[model samples]
Target: MTHTTLSTAQRDRAAGVLLGLACGDALGAGYEFGAPLPDHTPVRMQGGGGFGWAPGEWTDDTSMAIPLARAAAAGLDLRDETVLDGIVAQWVDWAKTAPDVGVQLRAVLSRTEPTASAVRQVAKAHHDRHGRSAGNGSLMRTAPVALAYLHDPAALAEAARLVSSLTHYEADAGDACVLWCLAIRHAVLEGELDLRIGLPALPADRRALWEGRFAVAETSRPADFARNGWVVEALQGAWSAIVTTPATDATHLRLALDAAVRGGRDTDTVAAIAGGLLGARWGASAVPAEWRRIVHGWPGLTAADLLRLGSSATPDLAHAQAESVDYAYLGDVSTLVRHPHDDGVWLGAAGALDALSAEIDAVVSLCRVGTKQVPTRIRHRVEVRLIDDDDPAKNPNLDVVLLDTVQVVAALRAEGHTVLLHCAQAQSRTPSVAALYAAVHRGVPIDRALAEVIAALPAAAPKRFLRDAVVRLAEANTDSPHQGPNTEGARA
Candidate 1:
């Protein structure tokens, strides 16, 4: 199936599929198979489940999905027999010594040859003997199938079933994959959560049945689905967590997944299932920087690898160029100045790294920099993906990225580390982010913060888009309850 070019919003949502999956998987890895926690309890990725997972480490749910994501990233048609066979081969290889594998999937994969046909036959025969093969295993890894056929719902439905059938032969399992994949596709394109959008794609006989299941999900809590090991209940549990949660913005993505994890048994699988759809709706920007910094899993992949794979899987995403930059024309790239509101923070261009004082122990980079741009001695270095362009489309998650970047700086400073914040030139991204940091963390008015920051850096001139975002964030912050640095008598 051919796909047309995607808008920036569409691209971000598309890239979020696997990213959200990994975040949910890792967050819930530590709490798997436990009873539901009391409401309002904090959920963290402090790993140590039945399988000893490291903090921020994903389990088999994401591990199983990686092969499909890799294939989609390679531009292969997911429904093609050759592609399916290759996916099966990868799964077989992964199961050899993987730390964790689902019981149903391990049974099917262990008995069959690595080929697609062999796996399908063995799966069907196993189902025939057991009279049931509707484990949630297949549904947990079905997120990537949506990325391959974002524009072709019919093909997506067919591919989802075919892929699920490779290890799960039950109709319920196939139907669940079809619904979830279609929901992900719709979420990516429309930025809304509507699972019923896929109902027409399912067989007419099964439409009402699934609709009723969705109705039950809406009325129930995630813990209501006690038999979550079954694919039907798993879908219900995931959907319940999503609908029951209230969100005013993209933070819904994190809160809903927290709801899923708190639902108890099979925590990782349920949360991973919800995360794919949440990521599709909110884009990668909605994910927290703290979580993105550490989430890693199978085959030695990090969050950045997942971002690349997700972006590559979607067609027509405009990637930023990695061409070498000429800093000589920009006059002085090394003009360093202390933040007007906080003495702990330093502001400058990328060139400021050349003569960093020993006091600067943390670095927050806003633009692309060389691998060795920051000194190795700086133990805490964060790279924020903020483009200098004024077009909103150029930076799809502009506001979220800005807020997250400043939060990173705030976090570093709260740890008592002096920080150096910089971009390519002190003109656009650097000044804008510095101003935001002052407004957010020092409790200074944004306009005053911008003026003070611009005064400190003679070359500072923020982009129109960034300036507008700063104003919006400042107004929003004023309305919300916030605790920042004690600025009672601090310098403006």
Candidate 2:
């Protein structure tokens, strides 16, 4: 139970489960209430549905889980009155504007009750009136309970039911939450899911029931196993997709997620439930970078933001020192990368100068309008100042700035140093400079250079505001008698 006993693998899985849940939620966000995605259609996060979210934006599932995670990070027992009260308060706040809300959940929260008992009473009333109130509501947000109590299965199982009972009073809903939490915890602690770990925690009859259900699930298809509104069927659906998918390698992880999301109705919540366990089993690196860039949640929390929150809940999860990764190459010309590539200059955001320079010979820091000298650990530093606007129309000096950027990067590459051109998010300003650098120094046309950079960094979409400036810069470079013929040269 000590922090010293926690392993790196445990930490990554804990982080992975939460992040994976968000990734699935975001991925399936677009598919909600829509027709089934055709087989082989790439499942990128597009972000428009009944909720009308921006692409990569998670829905109610992750939004509701965030408060629970924050409470767990604060070290409150999830079953405690204070913790449950705080969680429901957050739910009420989120529900006020949430684009999607479960019928039972909305009915319960609408009563303005913040206590677990009050919520449970309301849920029980709904169940009595409606015959079946065992919605997937509780199971969708239960991943964080696994992380909070991962070191103790009995505590996790108990806590999972308590949280579930708040809005899903049915025993099936509570039981499903317990099983899913145990599965997530097992994956985090043992590097894979082993349902036996949770078997002893259930009552004798429920235990026998789940064991048989799981046995049957081994051969069940997702469509048949998981029904959106029923908690037990939802778990069955999630586990079936996971058990049947061939997640033996990176390709399989993608395949597994594809299978999960393609389940159709309520795809986001089900895939999110399945994804948390899958991510816990496979580790965070199993997720692709393009997806990682866009995964975000309500209240403007990004993937990195959620990762830090997950890390906070699990104290043993070691975080790299700010900007600990060294220089890395995003492309042959230097594009999207986590570490600065060796043997190159780094063109990065304002804060990235230190991390970039730590491993390289020099750095070019881009800013909106002015420059400043910064003390650094590395030997060399260059400051490039330009208007930060995305459009060329707003910045009269954009042509001059682009020309200067091209010259600076050309000078660095001529000296045999790799250069990282990075703006914040590396989506706009950085790639623009790199495209201009390619056009001027390598004699490539501006359009061709821009096309190549876009191809290399799929996520780094250059801002269109720079179009006029880029064309002018390309035209000026084309007219130059000194334009080089080495179009194949690397200078990103």
Candidate 3:
């Protein structure tokens, strides 16, 4: 297992988790605690809603997932949320609609101190029912944690159970939680259905049923799988289709989605939730526009926005209520997006100037982002550019294209507008070195460049290697850092 970094798109794979989580929640939320599906949904299941639209909002399942994600962004362990209060503060300030919390979970979130509450409270809640209680809630919302701890399944299941305990207490319920995490783990690594991921972990009874279903090859003669009331059955059914359905086409996914929606009971939700696992594996192409359009709180955003948020290891969207992304550049205006999108954000002083020049009719917003242990800070600009022309560190084919970027605000004291600095989310030798030249040439005070970054960065060339990389970038860019301030200044 190589420890290489994930590419922008590869890292953004979890964007699917976000999208899938939200979509599943919104769609399933419509009918939470509703009447069971028709005794024989075969008829309605065969002819289902177009996008699982019953009032596509989200539920406790999805809502529960939000805290975990915010907790992750804050670097607080799920087992401990000393910083969760800050998250609660955000929720209190912006989230107008309260979540439809599960009975137990509602009580959990109702706690006054996020820090004091997230402790054993999460796991203890499910202790009595960890093995018996099985519900779709945990299975539905565990994707985010699964991706975050891809290398660790126990941690992933622990997160699912911890969260599930807040609301459910059943043996199968806990077991179901395990299946969902496995589904997501498989999705992240292969992005394709991987029955093996779950077969090893499912309970004997559930696993037996799943195997029974898998052994049955006829679509007409549905497998002996049970959809009675367990999360495992639904999850198993979904995964079965994912592996055998060969329905990667958006149309197929769309059709299957409608089938899930109208089948009523857990069937619709089962279909919708499982879709997240499958759709994520196949990528966005497998999801349909109709489903996205009808989903509640979707924010009507674009793929680019999703990708940008994905690169940063966080989804800064309407639900998250980001002050910066909350607004937009309507016309000739501009906005900036600054943050770490995995590999590490490479801030280019010179590239910032060039992007401003590129803005003939586009609106841009520049923002800043903090490092791993820091708080969330908005950068000023997020332009798309290659760090270096000849830096071999980049794989042109795999990088996130047309990135939403940010500026090195500190570089402003020197070149004002003309000064250039290069920054990237990918940690690459060429890109980091490229930043050196762009920073120095764009009048980035040489001392400031070294002091502000240099040693603090992993790729910052060792004193010996730093000189050549810096000189090379300087020689390539014609602009001088010491040059006069531009008419516009450095303000975005």
Off by over 4 Å in 1: 318-399, 415-420, 443-448, 475-492
Ranked candidates, highest TM-score first: 1, 2, 3
RMSD (Å) per prediction: 4.2, 13.4, 14.8
Q: Against the true structure, candidate 2 has what lDDT?
A: 0.69
State the C-alpha lDDT per candidate: 0.86, 0.69, 0.42
Q: Of the candidates numbered 2 and 3, which has the greater lDDT value?
A: 2
Per-residue alpha-carbon lDDT of candidate 1 for residues 233-349, written as tens digits (9 for 90 to 100): 999999999999996777788899999998999999999999999999988777777787679999988776687688878657524222334465778898899998999999998
Against the true structure, candidate 3 reaches a TM-score of 0.50
Per-candidate TM equals: 0.88, 0.68, 0.50
Query: How do the residues 1-492 of candidate 2 rate in per-residue lDDT, one tens digit apiece?
Result: 322234555565566777888988888888886655555667767889887888889988898889888887666789897779878888988899887898888998988567777777888888888877799989999998888887777888999999998888788888888888898888877776775577787888888888888877678766674366677777777787788877555344457777767777888888888878887776554555446656877777766666667766776543421333232333322233532222253444444443453345555555321222233343333434344565433342345446656676666667675555555445567767776776767666766666666545435565566645676667766864323433232232
Model 2 clash number: 16
Cα error, residue 222 of model 3, in Å, equals: 8.8
RMSD (Cα, Å) of model 1: 4.2
Best by TM-score: 1
Task: Give the number of the best model, judged by lDDT.
Answer: 1
lDDT of 1: 0.86
